[model samples]
Target: MKKNIPIFRTGDTIEVQVWVSEGSKRRIQLFEGIVISKRNRNFNFSFCVRKISNGDAIERVFHINSYNIGNVVIKKRGDVRKSKLYYLRNRIGKSAKIKELLTKK
Candidate 1:
């Protein structure tokens, strides 16, 4: 059975909880970042997330249908014009921030 993953798009700020295993022990790891890109290939669909930690940029690509993914929580919607936010890589500090898209809920 496929896990219920929320519908998300590039530029959205999201937190992904992943199941990590170390030998006989297992734990949930939280990865919070901005979605930079998405690849739609039917069952091979995947997405890339980027985040800054300790002054270094870290990016992780996760398969949407992977069982290791515990949950995906959308924090904020970004008002970006591009489908792939690759340009954000060159930015630093405040310049790298994406505008939040307001929605009537």
Candidate 2:
């Protein structure tokens, strides 16, 4: 399999566009969220995204090399120490926020 992965760390905000099939027609759907964790293991590489919808926390995992995914755009990088952000699951409101990492040019 060809490698075409984006360089995004856990805790970053990203948007994933995926192809959705509805009946005979197919369309691209956008799923935007913060990266909670990344399961990197060669071909089975996948990432989990978390977002608050309708006042409820929603999480979705997507495969890195899946054909169904159209795009994965990173919006912001975060300053975090852990590889898995499972602790964010317990956070709510303002407490669930992750600090943004600033890179100097």
Candidate 3:
């Protein structure tokens, strides 16, 4: 049996380094974005990340325990409503942004 570890949550901005394989080449790709939602728990866990690219909003879902994921670095925290930020899709520009929370280290 595999033991699950709690590592991330919604509203956290994280930089994820993922390993990608293309034929005989392997490389690490970096993705930085805010976690908008988390679903299930333990081995079935998954989360969605939202980022703006080329003046367009982009969202991606990643598994918690996938081999492609190399590391996750939390960059900032956000104040939000509900567990999922699906409403953000309808928002644009400044209205779509999440408020940053200052944390005491």
Number of the top TM-score candidate: 1
Provide the global lDDT of candidate 2 against the true structure: 0.89
**RMSD of candidate 3 to the true fold?**
2.4
Model 2, stretches more than 4 Å misplaced?
A: 2-4
22-76: candidate 3 lDDT, tens digit per residue: 9999999999988989997755688999998898877889886787888778887
Q: Per-residue lDDT for 18-86 in model 2, tens only? A: 899999999999998999999989667889999998889999999877889988889889999998999
Where does candidate 3 clash, by residue pair?
none
Better of 2 and 3 by lDDT: 2
TM-score of each: 0.94, 0.92, 0.85
Reference-based lDDT, residue 102, model 2: 95
Lowest lDDT sum, 10 consecutive residues, model 1, at: 1-10
Clashes of each: 0, 0, 0
Best by lDDT: 1
Models sorted by TM-score, best on top: 1, 2, 3
How displaced is residue 81 in candidate 2, in Å?
A: 0.7
